[model samples]
Target chain A: MQYQSQAVAKLYFTAAIGLFAGQILFGLILGLQYVVGDFLFPEIPFNVARMVHTNLLIVWILFGFMGAAYYLVPEEAERELHSPGLAVLMFWVFLVAGALTILGYLLVPYSGLAKMTGNDLLPTMGREFLEQPTITKIGIVIVALAFLYNIGMTILSGRKTVVNLVLLIGLAGLAVLFLFAFYNPDNLVEDKLYWWWVVHLWVEGVWELILGSILAFVLIKTTGVDREVIEKWLYVIIAMTLITGIIGTGHHYYWIGTPEYWQWWGSVFSALEPIPFFMMTVFAFNMVNRRRRNHLNKVAVLWALGTAVMAFLGAGVWGFLHTLSPVNYYTHGSQITAAHGHMAFYGAYAMIVLTIISYAMPMMRGRKAANSNRSQVLEMWSFWLMTVSMVFITLFLTGAGILQVYLQRYSDTPLPFMVVQEKIALFYWMREVAGVVFLAGLVLYIASFFVGSKDPEAAVEQAASPTA
Target chain B: MTRGGSLPETSRYPPGDLAVWIFILAELAVFAIFFAAYAFTRMQHVALFDQYQATLDRNAALFNTLALVTASYFVVRAVTAIREGRTASARNRLWAAVGMGGLFLLVKGMEYAHHLGEGIRLSTNAFYMFYLSLTFFHFMHVILGILVLMVLAMRTAAGHYSAQSHTDIESGASYWHMVDLVWLILFPLVYVMH
Candidate 1:
C-alpha cells in the first residue's frame, strides 16, 4: 500500500467478508424457515434469523464502505491518513458492539434482549432494521463520529479531489440521517414517516453518492482515463441523483396514513428514480470502452462492470416494476418487496463493496496489481455462481409474489395471508434451493483467497489490442 | 486566441461534453416516462383532467413559454458569439438568457401563489396533483438552469473561456436547452392540452 494507514483497510475488509458469510448463513436459515416452518423452532425462530441476516448485511456493508473510504481517501487526497490509530480503534469498537448485538438477538428473546439493553429508557427496538438496542445504537453513533472525524480531517488537510469530497458528503449524510433512527414516536404513522428518512434516504439518496464516487475511483485507476473526464461525469451523475432522490422519498409515504397526494408525487418521482442507475450503467461501460490501457486486474474490471449491469437490472428494472402507486397498492409489503430488496441490495451495495475489495486486496497484500490467474478464475466463478443464483432467487420470489398477490389481494374472494403462503410453498422451496446455491458461492468466494496465494501474480497480455 | 482549427471533429456528435449528453438523455427518459404516465392517467380520468385543465392560468403559462423560448434563443446566440471569438457579446447574451429564465420563474411563482391562495395543493385532487407535480418539477429545473447560466455568464465575463476552449459554455448551454425543451413539452401536455 502507498500509505501505512491504507493497510488498516485490510482488517476492515477481512471483517466485512467474514460478516458477509454470516449474513448468507442466516439468510439460508430464514429461507428454510419459510418452507419448513418449525425447522429451527424455539431455539432460533424466523424473526431472530431475519434480524441476524439483515443486521449482518448492514454491518458488513458498513464495514466495506468504511474500509473503502480508508483505502481510497488517502490515495485521492495525495496524503497519508490523519489518524490511522483512531481508525483501528473505531474498527474494534464497531465490531465488538455489532457482535454483542447479534449475540443478544440469537441468545435471548428479542423482548428479553430489549429489557437487558435498557430499551425501556429509550426504546428504539422492535423496529425493522433498527432492531439494535439503544446502547448499541448509541455506540454506533459514537463510532461513526470518530470515524468521520479521522477521515474528514484527512481529506480537508490534504489535496481535495471530487472523489474524496463526494465520499465525505455521502458519509456525512449517512451519519446525519441515521440520527432519525433514534426518533421513534409512539404514533405509528409519524414513526413510519421519519423511518424512511433514515432507510430510504440512505439507500436511495446519499448512499448513491458513496456508490458513485467509489465506482469512479476504480474506473479511473483501472481504465487509465483522464481524471478530469471522470470527475466531470461524477458531478453530473450525483447532481441528478439528489435532484431526483430527495423527492423520491414520497414513494414510501403512500398508504402510510400520511396524505393521499403522495400517491401522485411518489409515483411520478420514484418512477424517475431508475434514471440515475441507467446513467451509472452507461457511465461504467463508456469509461471502460474508452480505456487508455488494459489493466491487469481483470476480475476487478469484471466486478466494476458487473456492478453497473446488475444494479441497473435489480435496482432500476425491478424497482420500476412496482414503484407506481397503483401497482404498489397490490404489492406493498408482499414478497415482491422482499424480491426487490434482495437483488437491489446485493447488486448495488454488496457488489460494489466486493468490487472495491477485489480491486484493493491485491495491492494491500503486496501484489503488483492483481491476484494470481487461478485465484481470479475461481473468483470469477464465484461471481457468476452468486450473481446467477441471486437472479434466480429474485425470480422465484417474484413468482411467489405474483401468485401471492393474485390469491391474497386481487381475487374476487381473497384468501388470508397464511392460506396464500401455504399455497405458494413451492416457490419458497425453489427460493430455498437458490439460497443454498448462493451459500455455496460464498464458500467458493472465500476459498478464492487461499487457493492461489503461493502463485505468482497474473501476467498481462501486453500485445492485446484494446477494443471498445 | 486561435479558433476552429484546434477543435475536434464534433460533427458526428452532439455539442459539449459527452458526459452532459448522457445526463441529458437520462433526464429525457425520465420526462418521457412521466409524460406517458400522465397521458395514461388522463385517459382514465378525462373529466377530472378537463375540469382542472380549465382552472389553469393559460396566460401565465403562455408568458412563461415565451420567456423560455426567448431564453433558449439567447443561449444559442451566446454560443454563436463565443464561437466567433466575441467574449463580450457572449457574456451579454448569457446574462440576457439568465434574465429570461428569471422572468419565467417569476411568472411561474405567481401562478403557484395564485394556486396556494385558492387552497390548492398536491393533496387537493388527482388533477391538481399531476398539475402541481409536473409544473413544480419543471420549475425546479428552471431554477437549476438559471444557476448554470449564471455560472457560465460569470466565467465568460471573467475571460475564463475562449473560442478555442469553451466546452463549459457549450455544456452549460446544452443543459439550459434541455430545461427549456422539457418546458416546451410540459407546457402543452399539462397546460394547453385538454
Candidate 2:
C-alpha cells in the first residue's frame, strides 16, 4: 500500500533532467538573441529555441504528473497496478514522441515548416514558439490517451476510494481537455477563442483538480489527517475550480470578439479563482499544524505548502492585475501576461510536481527516512533559486508590459516599429537571465534525485524529529 | 488507529455512505453557482431570455420534469425495498428509475434538436449561450447519474446490496434526489418563471 513506484519514478526523474538541460540551453540562447540581434540567428533560431524552452516546461511537469499518478493510485486503492508494462510503455512512447516533436521544430525553418505542412506563408508574428503544427498536435493526443488507459485500468480494478476517484477524475479531465488539440479553428480570432479551451481550461480547470488531489495525498501521508477531512477538501477545491474556471474561460474571450458580457463574467469569476488556492494554502498548513504522526518528506511537504501560496499570488493576484477587460485591453499581449505565465507555471504546477517527486523518490528507493544534509541543502537551494528568479522575472516583465502597453497600445508617439522594438528589448534580456537562474535550480534538483543523501543516521534523526 | 467509537450500522447503511454524502454536498455548491449564473444572466436580458424561454416547449419540459421527479420516487422506493430485504423488487425499482432518467434525457435532446433546427445555436446570443451552457452542463450530470445508476444496478444484480449492505442504494438514491432537486430549480428558472 506504499504510495510510491520505483519504475515510474525513474522515468519521470530521467525526463526531468533531460528537460531541464534543454531549458537551460534554450534559456541561454533566448537571452543572447535579445542582446545581440542576428547573433546565431541560423543555428538554434530564436523561434525554435523558444518553442523548445516553453514546451519543455510543459512536458516535464506532465512527466511529474504521470509519476505521481503511478505512485499514488495503487497506494490509495491498496493494490498493485493492473499492468506495470503499460505504465512503462506510456513513458517511452511519450518521451520519444516529445523528442521527435522538438526535433521537427528544429529541423524546419518557421516559414519552410509552414510551407511543407501547407499553411499559407505570412510575416512571422515573432511568437515562433507558439506555432503548434498538426502532427505535433496529434502527438499530444496519443500521449494523453496512453496515460488515460493506464490510469483508467488501474482505478477500475482496484478499491474505490474518494481520494483515488477524485484524482482519476482530474486526470480524466486532463485527457478530455487535450482533445482540444484536434480542433484546428480556421480563423485567427476563432483559433485564439478555442485556444482557451486547452490552455485556460487545463490549467485553470483540471489543473485545479490535480492540485487538490496532490495536496490531499500529501496531507494524508504526512499528517494522518482524517480521510473525511481530506476528501471534503478535495471536493470543495474541484467544485470551486469548476464554478470559477468554466465561466472564467470568459477572461480569455474578452479580446477574441466573443461577447462583451465576458468582460464582467470573467472579471467576477476569475477574481474568485484565488479562493481555492488560498484555501489550499490554509489546507496544507492547517493539516501540518494538526499532524497525528510525523513523516519523512518534510521538504516535499514544504514545497506543497509553498505551491498553494505562490499559486494564489501568481495565478490569482497577478492574473487579476490584467484579467479585467479594462486592464486586459492595455496588457493583452504585453510582457505583463508573460510575467503572470512564468510565476503561475512555477508556482502552481512546478512546485506541485516537485512535491510529488520529492515525496516519492525516497520511498521508491526504499529509503526509510528523509535524505541527509546535502540533499536538503540542494532542495532548499532549488526552492530559493526558482522563487527568487521567478519574482525578478515577474518584476521585469510587469515593468516591460506597462511600458510596452503605454507606448504601443495607447500612445501616438512617433517611434517606428523597429525603433520601438529596440526600446522595449531590454526586458526580454532580463527574462532570459531570470530563466537561466531558474534553470540552475532545476539542474541541482535533477542531480539531487540521482546522487541523493547516503547518511542514514542523519536521515533517521530528521525523520524522528516532529517537524518532519 | 482502530477506535472504539465507530458507528454501528443502522440496518442497511455503511459508514462509507457518509463520504458519498459529503461529495454530493460539494457538487451541489458547484451546481448552485451555475444556477445562480443562469438566473443572473436571465435577469441581464429579461426580454430576450423570455423570448427564448417561450421557444422551449413548456409541455415537453413539464414532462421531463415529471419524469425526473418520478425517477427520484422510484429510487427512494428501491432503497426502501432493499432495506426491507426485497432484493429482486429493489432491483426492479432501481431499473425503473434508470429508465425514467434515460427517458427524460431523450425528450430533452429532442427538444434541443427541435430548437437547433429553428436556428437557435450557442453563439446566437447571450440567451442561447446560457441556454446551451446550462442545459449541456446539466445533460452531462444526467449522463453521470445514469452511469452511477448503472453501477448500482450491476452491483445489485451481483447481490452486493442487501438489508445489511445497502449503503450503495442509499448513496445512489441520494444522488438521484439531487438530480431531481436541480431539475426542480431549472424547471422554474429556465422554463416557466422566465
Q: Write candidate 2's Cα lDDT for B63-86 as tens digits.
A: 999999998888888888999988
> Model 1 lDDT vs. the true structure?
0.92
Candidate 2 per-residue lDDT, tens place, A137-168, comes to 56667777877787778788888878788778
Identify the candidate with maximal TM-score: 1
DockQ of 2: 0.09
TM-score of each: 0.95, 0.73
Steric clash pairs (candidate 1): none
Tens digits of per-residue lDDT for model 1, A55-174: 999999999999999999999988999999999999999999999999999999999999898999998888899999999999999999999999999999999999999999999999
- Determine the C-alpha RMSD for candidate 1 after optimal superposition of all C-alphas: 3.0
- By summed lDDT, the worst window of 10 consecutive residues in model 1 chain A runs over A459-468
TM-score of 1: 0.95
- Per model, how much of the real contact set is kept? 0.78, 0.00
C-alpha RMSD values across all candidates: 3.0, 6.6
Q: How many residue pairs clash in each candidate?
A: 0, 0
